[model samples]
Target: MRVLGIDPGSRHTGYGVVDGHGNRLVHVTSGTIAVPGSLPFPERLGVIFARIDALIRQTAPHECAVEDVFMSRNAKSALILGQARGAAVVAGVQAGLPVFEYSALQIKQAVAGFGKADKEQVKQMVRTLLRVTGRLSSHAADALAVAVCHLHSRTSPLCRQVGEQR
Candidate 1:
């Protein structure tokens, strides 16, 4: 199975694609979609939707995993994040890709063996698991980690139940 994982942000959304079979995962591509801060919020959203839609068409992923909105002390920041996530979901739905949402904690636990793992630890774990070298931004690595989490967790009863319905 091929999965596209998304870490949504108003300014920079990160995405990672991976091929997985059973419990094993192989990296395909990983990067960020950077929206200029100078652009209007609506324009930025349009850019995000268009880029992600094109990515979905090009990669043709079988599934998509997105990090759910994490609560933030700043309500404004949370709202903007939610908007980005909405655009992402719209793109996936338009592409007819099955989208699944996972929490940051879930992704950390699955990738780093602990929910409370720090960002650096999660990055290291993602690098080791995907067997890649060099540094990836916390955003990019987090997106990849979400993909890894889905690969390992997709066979759970939750996913099976959803798949069976389709």
Candidate 2:
């Protein structure tokens, strides 16, 4: 199965595509959709949406794995991140793909074997697991990790909770 992972940010939305068979993972593409800082908020959102849409069309992923929004100390930052996440979801739905969401802790644990793994560790694990040699921004690598988490969870009954089966 092919999964598209998204790490949404107001200024830069990172995305990656991973193909999984059973428990194995293969990296397809990874990049960031960066909006100019000078652009207005609305325009930046538009840019993010367009880029995400294009990515979905290009990769044709069967599903999308998105990072769940976490409460932030800064309210403005949280709101902007939420907006970007919304746009990312729309892009997946528009491309007729099923969307999956996972918490930051879940992703870290799945990818790095620890919920508190740092960014560098997560990036390294993603690179190692996907066997990717090309350059990948940390944010994009994190997104790819999210997709990997979903793929693992889907194949392992132990990872499923009671309510998730429905």
Candidate 3:
């Protein structure tokens, strides 16, 4: 199964593509869709939506995994984050891919074995799991982690049971 994972941000949304078979996973691509901060917020959202749409068309993923919005100290910031996530989710749905949302804690626990793992730890774990040697941006690493988390969740018996129930 080919999965596309998204870590959405107003300024820099990250994405990763991975192919999974049973317990094995292979990374296909990972990158950040950088939107200039100078642009208007609405325009930035449009750019994010367009880029994500393009990515879905290019990668043709069977499913998509997206990190859910987390509460922030700044209410405005949190709202923008949620908007960005909405745009990404809409792109995935429009592409006709099964979209799954996972919390940051879930992603961290799946990739790093701890919910409170730091960015460095998550990056290291992603690198180790994907057998990647090159440098990866934090956003891209997080996106890859989301992909890995989805694959892990899909293979879990409990998750499968829950999914079937739904």
lDDT (CA) for every model shown?
Answer: 0.88, 0.85, 0.89
lDDT of 2 at 48: 84
Number of the top-ranking candidate, with lDDT as the measure: 3
lDDT of 1 by residue, 1-166 (tens): 9999999999999999989976678888888999999999999999999999999988989999998888999999999999999899889988988888888888999999999999999999989999877768878898999899888888775443112352
My TM-score estimates for the predictions, one after another, are 0.92, 0.91, 0.93
The alpha-carbon deviation from the true structure for residue 90 of candidate 3, after best TM-score superposition, in angstroms, is: 0.6
Between prediction 2 and prediction 3, which has the larger lDDT?
3
Between prediction 1 and prediction 2, the one with superior lDDT is 1
List candidate 2 segments past 4 Å from native: 155-166
Worst 10 residues of 3 by lDDT: 157-166
Ordering by TM-score: 3, 1, 2
Please give, for residues 107-134, the per-residue lDDT of candidate 2 as tens digits. Answer: 9999999999999999999999999897
Q: How far off is residue 123 in model 2, in Å?
A: 0.4
Per-residue lDDT of model 3, residues 18-119, tens digit only: 999878889999999999999999999999999999999998999999888899999999999999988998888888888888889999999999999999
